[model samples]
Target: MSLAVGAVSSSKNMGFDESKDSEEKSHVSESSKNLPPPSPTPTEEALREGEKYNRQMSETSLYATEEEEDDEERKIELGPQCTLKEQLEKDKDDESLRRWKEQLLGSVDLNSVGETLEPDVKILSLSILSPDRPELLLRIPEAGNPKGLWFTLKEGSRYSLKFSFKVSNNIVSGLKYTNTVWKTGVKVDSTKEMLGTFSPQAEPYTHEMPEETTPSGIFARGSYSAKTKFVDDDNQSYLSINYTFDIKKDWPSTS
Candidate 1:
């Protein structure tokens, strides 16, 4: 893995590099790092005192991710699309291209191909993994899930988030995700990571974000709000959601 300061590991079979869709480069840090607060957006700057972000409800959201405003700066160029079958058939006369295509295809099941105009990326689940601790996996609903504090994390513990997803139809390019976290209406953390491009395959791909240590101390424990989004290079959003969670002194007992 390329080890993007704060991203996770992915197998070589996946696209991109350890820094492979490394599956991603991340912008994540604990509050203890004293990351400077995100600059206020123009729209945010114009809000009146009564409507400032600090007092906003979770539904209205708790942070500002400047990604949309600066899309072009972060955008990666994508090439013309070709189905795996078509690509495999093309330049079959060339030995080099054939070998390259073989490596890219990597035992991918040909029958899994589907007829669709655009690639469909389905996020299956999200999990929280920590050394010596049980995995906390969140089942993703097809639509919006009922909003609430779904789980708890032990403050100061090391943990990472993992995702499982499937892609069908055409190839999805620059697959990535962003996560922004807030506490008591103040933005605390944000991240963007590239999972790289992927071919439509029968099996789902799972990516685990690099581990993060939750901030501890008196002020860290409590309820928090988070917004997570999954999107592609073309700016297509597969999912965007607002949910709640908590960091506490101890993990919740399974019993």
Candidate 2:
């Protein structure tokens, strides 16, 4: 009886130990399910590193392409280049234009030129006088005057031309005298030379002609008209007067 009781107790003890062990094992398994995962292998780590490197290289290539495109766009914005042949042709065209202008200016007439008159000045009278015969104040001959009443001057005779002028407001800085002779309404001879320069003067000035000689010889004997031109300080003509006179071979005998 004592041996059988001992054996039964031992069997009970073994069953209790086994049940405890199984419960502990179940708790361990539950705890293990909540734990973190394991570390990656070397192969997986290498694949990840290669993917990052490839992404970085793609971005770098894109940036370099953008820079190259910007440079090309800037080059296109610049204007077309001028070649040496085009520059030479432009210079030749400019030279041709200059020569054409010079030729156009060379064809102008200078002899028959006349300047416009300034209205501020006018000539009052112009007459011829002989110093040798002071009483001979030769005036313009009238149709009703005696047949010999015209101004008769011998060849090589010295005479003075008298002129009176009036200026409205401006000053006369210079004076020019031009003499022209006409026969039968046609100009025969003329003196285009400037006679003298005068100081600045106001209106109502009288200028005496310097002593002059009449043309000599047979060709000088004829009806003639004398014209005198007066120019102002500005080199512009202001007044001109005409006088009729005759050249004779000899003076009339004084009775």
Candidate 3:
């Protein structure tokens, strides 16, 4: 009886050991199947980095080429220079054309009855003259010189404003004169007068300034412009001119 019991106990211990070994082997196989892929080699990582750098360089080079092409497209090449003689001839032709137009317009008959009215009136001259000082007349300078209409106005003094016009058609119009001062502030003085039916055969009309007090604050030593407008019967402006002048606190000493 004792020997049979010993044999049975030995068999049971052996069976338990075999079962544990099989369970451990199955667990190891499952763990290996669930594991992530191995990391890339250093060489492979370097090759990928090199490829990315090459792609960036290629893109930058292509962009630079496109910008260069655009710059070339926008660059303008100047034409051949004209000869001095050619330029002079061109200027002469322009002057002749201008004179022809003036003469043709001047000869037109404007006083004929039932003739259509035209805004062909021309301002012959416009000036602000000082009777006391003949040299102080405001004059329009020719172009390419120091071009500006300038006058030196003395405080508390009066000036004469004159303007003349020539018409090529029978048009009833009026003169609207305006004097303004503007800098840090603005002030305006205006006057209007009727001019009856004007014709080319009529003499140029002239007017002088009326007696009036100059605005007090206008004599501040700065720059200002005086403007005049020629308006038709309906108050529509057809011609305008402006003059710029400076104001002085005191007149220059003659000595």
Candidate 4:
């Protein structure tokens, strides 16, 4: 009986040991399957994923900012809106045309038909050359020799003279006011003479043509006046500008 009881106790202990070992092994296998890979830690994977997302977001934001900057640098104007350079160029063109119109309108310092008027040494000499058109080459004083307008007007005598003038300003309507009379002699009475003067009928200025190397200039008559002589060399001559005149640009520069 003792022996049999000892044997039964040993057998029970062995079975318990085997069952415990099997339970331990099964628990280890289940735990290992639930866990992730060992080489790449779970924390490292989370960190790497976060870094990749941040890099993609940064790249997208950088591209968007660059596009916005490019849009800001360039501006578009659809219609009528002029830029600064364009406005400046237009103003320059207008100023140039105004000066041309003034020059082409002629001056008020000239005498009537077949008369002579004194020339101002200061303002009259400003015109370097007539507004790029057919200009009558006036004889300039060569260093020492100076020839001026020398004409004697007879009392009660009516005459008409033609001269080549320049049109610097294009304002043809106000041609009379723009003109300046520099000199005038003593006035004489011509009450008995039936006088008739041929004023400027149209503008003497021409347009720019294709064959024209330089820009074609304009010219016009401003006014007209009569002369009444009182003295021999001091005869009074009437002077005026003819606003209506003709223009011819098919000519070359004389100077």
The C-alpha TM-scores of every prediction are: 0.67, 0.39, 0.44, 0.16
Please write out the lDDT profile of model 3 over residues 1-255, one tens digit for every residue: 999999989988777577787999999999999999899777988999999999999988774332363355346343443332232235455878657544533443423423433445665665656544554434443322224735566665667667777664444434344444554445444454555545354567666666443434544566666555566544445565566666676555545
Please provide, for model 4 over 104-196, each residue's C-alpha lDDT reduced to its tens digit, 9 standing for 90 to 100: 433432222112122111112211122333324333232332233322222222222222323221111211111212122222112212122
Model 2 stretches astray by more than 4 angstroms: 1-119, 135-150, 183-188, 192-203, 233-236, 251-255
In candidate 1 the C-alpha lDDT for residue 180 amounts to 85
Say which prediction, candidate 1 or candidate 3, comes out ahead on TM-score: 1
Report per-prediction Cα RMSD to one decimal.
Answer: 27.8, 41.2, 22.6, 31.1
Ranking by TM-score: 1, 3, 2, 4
Better of 1 and 3 by lDDT: 1
Off by over 4 Å in 4: 1-149, 154-156, 168-173, 177-255
**What is the Cα root-mean-square deviation between model 1 and the actual structure?**
27.8
lDDT of candidate 3? 0.55
Write down the worst ten-residue block by lDDT for model 3: 80-89
Model 1 over residues 20-66: C-alpha lDDT tens digits?
Answer: 33233343334436777678775745666546545666545654447
User: Candidate 2 lDDT, tens digit per residue, 1-255?
Assistant: 999999989988777677787999999999999999889676987999999999999988775332373355345343343332232234555878646633533332222222222325566665667655553544432322223434677777788778766654222344566777887877777664454433123436677866788788888887787765666444466755566678888654545
Inter-residue clash pairs, candidate 2: none
Decoy 3 TM-score against native: 0.44
Report lDDT (CA) for all predictions. Answer: 0.79, 0.58, 0.55, 0.33
Q: What is the lDDT of residue 47 in candidate 1?
A: 68
